[model samples]
Target: MNVKMNGFISLVLGIGLLHTASAATHSLKYFYTAVSGDIDYPEFTAVGLVDNGQFMYFDSSTKTAVPKTEWMKREGADYWDSQTQGLIGEHQTFKVNIQTLKDRFNQSKSTGVHVVQRMYGCEWDDDSGATEGFDQYGYDGEDFIAFDLKTTKWIAPAPQAVITKLKWDSNTANNEHRKNYYTQECIDWLKKYMDYGKSTLMRTVRPSVSLFQKTSSSPVTCHATGFYPSDVMVSWQKDGQDHHEDVEYGETLPNDDGTFQKSIHLTMTPEDRKNNKYQCVVQVKGIKDDFIRVLPDQDATNVVPIIGGVVALLLVVVAVVVCVVIWKKRSKKGFVPTSTSDTDSDNSGRAAPQI
Candidate 1:
């Protein structure tokens, strides 16, 4: 279906652990998250571990990652906003605990290096009407400690230092008591968003199409602009058949107003331009029909202006030749006789011509 369901509505319905060594240098480890929704609906959440304001990793809802590379996991960040920063905590006690752990790893108690940890939590109603919670635990070094948030208090069973510092607090107790209520609220919100998604309530403006010759030697381009939801397909067709070879696709980019634009090009030759049989077809997700644009006929192109220019130039040349010929003939008739004998007149009034 090529459905591009960005998590905006999916969150209304729904929604790991590691340790590190001690003695690591003081590096920034940020446990950041953004969560929205209430008790009755699902809460959409994005949790990540960032280092120095740059992303290191994130929990993928689809278990898939973009740029699909070796160090990157399968993760989708479509629901996250790049401009918005999540909350941060100083974690004074956690820092002290990590320093103690580092000391244990080092035979010599080193005080210069420190290990940092960060954690995030979110809850939402699942599609099956069940309340679910998600947590992310992150650390700066390879030998850091892990924190579990499923229970009311954060727990790290290792290195008595971490356990002692992360004792259960009154706030955590209060959150634990309201957990059920929060889950139900998320479920309610999920229902509302689902209805909104299914309702015929949103505006559906058709995409605008434009064509261009990218360069004198390059392909012909078809651009579709101002579409929504970022799900669209643009392709070229030759004589009613889809043309896949010699086609190039551009990434869909967001507009200031949140709409999207994309372009596709067909490698067209001078002969292909003359045929006038190529078509650009655009299909939007959730829309049943396709928008198509056809190539202009050769006669309707700039060739007409070029031909008219040639004809005008020929007319100017012919006019100049005619004027020059007439001037030469007139000059000959007005020529004066060079010899006195040629101009001498006898009893007749007419002048005699020279040999």
Candidate 2:
């Protein structure tokens, strides 16, 4: 009976040890929140170590006596190191003590895990080729980091020095003032970063569209008002297709409210007046797309006054022409009788022998 009991006890211990080893190998190594402007640390507990890897502690930050192994294992070092060289350095190593790392994990309890396999030194650019003295760190492609209860190993974040957003504004009365608006190029660059997982969000103010009249004789002019100018794309579309190379765009204006505004002018021609349909599409980064149409009704209304004035002027001109024609006819009849009288009088005098 004693021998049997000993064998059962050994088997149970072996199973327990194997389970612990498995748990430790896949633990979470980091925790963080990407949101800024709040408290520095998370409100929950996290754990990490060189030997056991990294894992999350499910208990709240306020709780004591939480089991470390029971915390979720989300990421390992291998995943983090492969995505970016932002954290790699020749002298970089996991120099932080395990106890210190644990204390940091518990102190800044976050709702998610951010595990990094390696950290490296980097320089900060403040211009002038000068760098801040603080040692910067990033993850090599081999490092793994994550947050929350996610099971997949996460790629380490990119360098913190990247620009996240750009703002543009224009003060010109109507986008009539031609200038190169860098807003689109800026957005394209930001998108590149977003595609690479470097930025979390892109934000900006709405952009404005304006229409101006370029023809002196044409009184049909329209203006687009009340658009915010930050982080927006202004484009002109004619007849449902994009008018790319032919159309000219204006400078992106900055508004006092930290937004952006811009305008464009198309010279109204007989052909344009005839077709009479145009559209301006504004695409704001991270916001819904907006489109404003210049319908036939709107265009007709704008041209109505000009048409009325032209019609009135034409009537006056025709009335003057008619009056001139009538006067010329009457003058011709009156002058013909006078000339006939003179001719008759002269002939009678000649024939009456000097009477």
Candidate 3:
């Protein structure tokens, strides 16, 4: 018996409604990358899944939604290995087939994500129940393609003859074969993986910002760091207008700790800085508010208090120094030197007043 499949069935029943319990949508993806030259190689192949529009599963060695039993793992690994060989071999017939699958998946995911967005906005549920689907992609040298299982269509960009042959094959035994593999067995595995990932994936971390100046006159840079969900946008603005020129954008990259970071710079001339204000704005997907950083201006409002404090401090210091000097001078002049001799009068050797 399928242990994982039984657990999925029990979960749906225990939750009362599959529509409410199961993910609103499911997606399976196949990724392939290969290089060719004096040395030919198929570098990597991975299968991934997305549930309810969130990334859920990606493993290079294992097939999606497969049973975790030792026998099944070995079998699934062998099957994927064979599939990879079909993609790598020269003069292969499966290349077009693979490309078709990739195209179908690309189309599905592109459209599927949109559907989920609409579902989120709807007031009431259609109650049509939970749905599952798979998308496939293949990359060979410079070529890329996709296939969507839901639409039973190919998205391979290739010669007409090759595409035509793929269409014919897909309509025949390939159709039944794919339906069995994806809809039935693979989906069971997808459910298993989804359950495992639900508790494990990181979510709901906000980004932090750091600002720095390159030089006395160079542009200011804003670095936004430690954000979850890789899709974040960082932009620069001046006096309420978005400035595109003299702006350098850095690619968003993953941090070692599984978060993401991005940097953007805005160049403001001396004249511009004197007249207007600048702000850095960051927007993250699923975040309600945008993160904004306004450039510090030495305008009257800010500079007045600072200048006033400095002047006051200087005045206090000067006053203290003047008082000390006056006191010391008075003490020195008033000093009546005691005569060493008993009867010696006051200022004889001290140089009498010129008056």
Using lDDT as the measure, what is the rank order of every candidate, best first?
3, 1, 2
Q: What is candidate 3's lDDT per residue for 12-53, written digit by digit as tens?
A: 001111112222333333222221222222222222223212
Alpha carbon lDDT of each predicted model: 0.38, 0.27, 0.39
lDDT of 1: 0.38
Best by lDDT: 3
TM-score against truth, every candidate? 0.36, 0.26, 0.45
Show where candidate 1 strays beyond 4 Å.
Answer: 1-201, 302-355
Q: Judged by TM-score, which candidate is best? A: 3
Candidate 2 per-residue lDDT, tens place, 1-355, comes to 0112111111111111111211111111122111111333322222221111211222123332122222211223332232112112111223232123324335335333232221111122213322211101112111122111111112222222121101001212111111111122222322332333222112333444444443443433233333432234566667887655445554333232323344454444566656756666666544566746453433354633333443453344333220000011111112110001112111111010000
List residue ranges in candidate 3 displaced over 4 A.
1-30, 38-42, 45-143, 148-151, 158-172, 175-191, 212-221, 241-251, 265-274, 285-289, 297-355
Winner of 1 and 3 under TM-score: 3
Error of 2 at 114 (Å): 52
Error of 3 at 85 (Å): 11
TM-score of model 2 (CA atoms): 0.26
lDDT of 1 by residue, 1-355 (tens): 1112121111100110221111111111223222211222111122221111112323223322122122222223432222122111122234344444444546225423232333322233233343443222222222122223345443343353354325433345434433432344323433333343322213354788877663456566787877753457799998899988889976454343435567787886778767748889998765778999887755564421222343353344333220000011111112221101111101011111110
